[model samples]
Target: MSAVVRGLVARGAGQELTVEDVRLPRPDAGEVRVRIRAAGVCHSDLSMVNGTLAPPFPLVLGHEAAGVVVEVGDGVERVRVEDHVVLNWAPACRQCWFCRHDEPWLCASSGTPAVARGATADGAQLHVTLGLGALAQEVVVPQHAVIAVPPALPWAEAALLGCAVLTGVGAVNNTAAVKAGDSVAVIGLGGVGLAALTAARAAGAGPVIAVDVSPAKRELALAAGATDYLVSDDRLAKTIRELTEGRGVDHAFECVGRSATIRTAWRSARRGGQVIVVGMGAKDDEVGLSALDIFHSARTLRSSVYGSSDPDREVPELARAVLDGSLSLAPLITDRIPLDAAPAAFERMARGEGARSVVLFDE
Candidate 1:
């Protein structure tokens, strides 16, 4: 048995996505077939399309999604049919070197072809993005890739938990270990930036500053609990320092995934402060710093992959925060459209139009 479903497929680098009929096979052993209810359009997906992060072509390009498990293959014990789950793109293999060493987010086998199991209508093997493609109405992923969430959780908001929320909040809570009264600045006001803002506020960080080039995102940032907002410009670092009493923020987050924004994040941090890189940038893009400056800065630079999250443990906690009103997933979702409208959504994202645009599927 097979399912023919419409999905956004990227046929080649720098090409626009085409909605095509994808033929998905039934769940193989250790796999689960999910009926995607909602999927978030992320910059990472755009990177795959634009050739920044090269995945195999003819790929289904989406990873942030939530859905219901409609069927499970033999030996699947993590979840049962009808279980609501947040699709985790990086499903760690516990026996892998990274996982055994407590760095499961960097699991060696998470996003390889060895884990993908699907095909296209023409019988060509389909390469799923991050090994958990959610652009389609249905997906068959490894059992570990689906983390069960409460059924009461709304599919649209829960969809973001897999990517933006985990990366944003996890960066603060797990990676940076932000403490109360620490000054924080987030350079970018997208879903990930807002999630950082919300987590910073929850952590009692002082003067959580949000920076972005777009003036329209000020309100969204403020509503997400940023104490201050600044537009990205030549004097951004000076303005941030002035706001922090001639000292830059204690912690700065780079969420835009560009060399320029990354420089801004590094320059906006106080001496000895931590600059956390949360965005996924192009492999070729590089940020240059003088040797003397690096020596004198006395700052720590680190990258936060998937928010340094262990999905099995963090996704549920994040969901609980949303359920308890401690976290605001509502502000992050700026637009909701059907799957066919994903191209327009991508255009909006490219224009920095809104925070997140989710593709909703019929119940």
Candidate 2:
């Protein structure tokens, strides 16, 4: 049996999120009901509040969550009852061209068939944030969106691998694939930026420069593996070149979603280097780059969605890294609040004052 639990929901723009009791129905075929243990409060939630990620009304606003599987619907063999798991927002359908071609992250972009999963408590059907909305105490998601984890990994630490960690680390390791001894510059020291720093360090990158406006975040970046830190400003481009002996770093990752930061990430890369745009800036915003630069610089820029990840393969490996102390996730948490405090937590994120606030639930 599953219990109705509290969760944060954005009714609309400029409106306070109301904490409500929502029900979780029994899992249908190819579905599982998860009892969410920890949900990360991400900036995307603030975007939803301010009408940035405008999808639907009264949306459950979080994508980074991990929990336990208490019940599995029919034909669910990958996970069993009581199995610990990480909820992935992007699930790939095996038959899709992207999935069959070794790029599951680009899975056809179709809606999950609702016949496989039951409706919400209020009988008002809703779409999951990227497909797995794990913010609630219970989530009825397709089996493909769930990644089972080792019991030793705490739910809170594992939650981030679902999105933030994957986007950050995967941007460097998978998308950029920066080589050992390469120089890196990462703009925006949020959760993903910090993860990028750690991944860059692990990849043997030298002089990994971290750029951000927040000094607290600069400190966080240093702890995560940044060799140097800088404040974001009009001189950011010039400073990045100055740091890399007037050549700039080999790779630059923009994890913060903004046009200016996006351009900064581009300029931070050395000529012929790679610039990976991991940030999700406004669709309307455009960057002004001299057409000659494309030919003159020979740099490569690519969009990183879900960190180009295959969750079934990446989540468990990340969890193992966490267990070995090579991946420091437990310390990244700045606030741990109950499900009721989600609104306040998101507000804190909007103010750029929190590291990673997680919403916990009694399981």
The per-prediction tally of clashing pairs is 0, 0
How much does candidate 1 score in TM-score?
Answer: 0.97
Candidate 1 CA-lDDT value:
0.90
Against the unseen true structure, what C-alpha lDDT does each candidate score? 0.90, 0.80
- The pairs that clash in candidate 2 are none
Worst 10 residues of 2 by lDDT: 110-119
Q: What tens digits encode model 1's per-residue C-alpha lDDT throughout 1-363?
A: 988888988788878788899888888999899999999999888888776776786899899999999999999999999999999989898998999999999999875632345677788788788887798899998899999999889998899999999999999998999999999999988889999999999999999999998999999999988999899999999999999998899999999898988888889999899999999899889998778878999989899999999999999998888888778788899999998899889888888889999999997
lDDT for residue 97 in candidate 1, whole number 0-100: 91
Q: Work out the TM-score per prediction.
A: 0.97, 0.94
Could you tell me how far off, in angstroms, the CA of residue 243 lies in candidate 2 after the best superposition? 1.2
**Candidate with maximal TM-score:** 1
**Could you tell me the lDDT of residue 250 within candidate 2?**
95
